[model samples]
Target chain A: DAGITQSPRHKVTETGTPVTLRCHQTENHRYMYWYRQDPGHGLRLIHYSYGVKDTDKGEVSDGYSVSRSKTEDFLLTLESATSSQTSVYFCAISSSGGTDTQYFGPGTRLTVL
Target chain B: AQSVTQPDIHITVSEGASLELRCNYSYGATPYLFWYVQSPGQGLQLLLKYFSGDTLVQGIKGFEAEFKRSQSSFNLRKPSVHWSDAAEYFCAVGTTTGNQFYFGTGTSLTVIP
Candidate 1:
């Protein structure tokens, strides 16, 4: 098991509200990623951070934003929640980029009404 | 562009029966492949991964996968099925440079005793 944890394990909120999910890793991994899991679509990458203040968009980066101010914490924020944004979000950490095995966090299930 | 495909949307097998899940990938170069299992309401756990070297890769929980370049496939197999193994499985393809991973739609496994 990796030293990764996600806060607000479960939440439900109305649409058009602001929501932020937090991923914290004690392993001090250099790479952190945010992904959304939906049925029949698998898991889609939302965003990723390689270092502090360095981030990149993923295949499904729309309606979501991420920030990495410290090595241990990466935050994903939905500026305005939408029904389509309801999904289980996962955070993963890797010591090296690509080819290296990534350990995942427990996950956060968010629901937008 | 790199992409992963899981042929079977859902499969059911007897407890003692052998199980195999098909995965095919599309990539220009030698792609990094991985298989992950996710229980209901849980995070994705890495079952195994193939980077290079060995064609057959072994993973945790008595799972193994063979990376066949000729077929562009990385199929997961187990000699005996377990009820606990009933979950969704995802196949992913990644590149050596980009910190990106493309996942398949996922296959749901149902093990019946």
Candidate 2:
């Protein structure tokens, strides 16, 4: 499990509501990432952080934001959740920068009605 | 932009049969390649990765992948398939510029008895 854990393993929310997912890791990895998995989209990067307070948008970062206040925790927020945001969310950590191996967390399944 | 293509959306094979999943990437430079397997409703597990040196990379669970620069491909192969191997497989390409990764849609494997 790579010492990674995601909160709210499964949740159902109403459309237009706010939702936040938490990813916590004990590995002290320098890099952390948020990804979404869908039926035809496979896995798409949502946001990533290289260090505390250092974050960047990914391929599908629109309508979503992230924060990394500490080295062990990265948070993903959907200010206004939409049905399109209903997907499996995964958190990953890497010891180094990109091109390094990433270990993934169990994942959180979110469904927006 | 960078993209990963998994030609086969799904594949079926009998138990104990050889299995191969294709992964092709379009990149200007040599990027790190990886193969991951995800069981139903679970997080992805790293199967193998190719960074440098030998083209053939061995990973956990009796899985291996061949990085063919000539073909711009890194294919995952297993000599014998197990029923437990029936899951979704994803291929990812990582670049050095940023903490970015492009993943293929996925290849759903069905191991029949």
DockQ of every model listed? 0.81, 0.85
For candidate 1, lDDT tens digit of each residue in A23-80?
9999989999999998888999999988999999999999999999999999999999
For residues B15-86, could you state the per-residue lDDT of candidate 2 as single tens digits?
Answer: 999999999998877789999999998899999999999999999999999999899999999999999999
Off by over 4 Å in 1: none
lDDT of 1 by residue, B1-113 (tens): 78899999999999989999999999999899999999988888999999999999999999999999999999999999999999999998877767778899999999999
TM-score of 2: 0.98
Cα shift from native, residue A59, model 1 (Å) = 0.7
lDDT of 2 at B92: 95
lDDT of 2 by residue, A40-77 (tens): 88999999999999999999999999999999999999
Residue range with the least summed lDDT across 10 consecutive positions in model 2 chain A? A93-102
- TM-score per model (chain B): 0.97, 0.98
DockQ of 2: 0.85
Extract clashing residue pairs from model 1: none
Interface RMSD of 1: 1.0
Give the per-residue Cα lDDT of candidate 2 at B41: 82
- What lDDT does candidate 1 reach at residue A14? 96
Query: lDDT per prediction?
Result: 0.93, 0.93
Displacement of the residue B88 alpha carbon in candidate 1, Å:
0.9
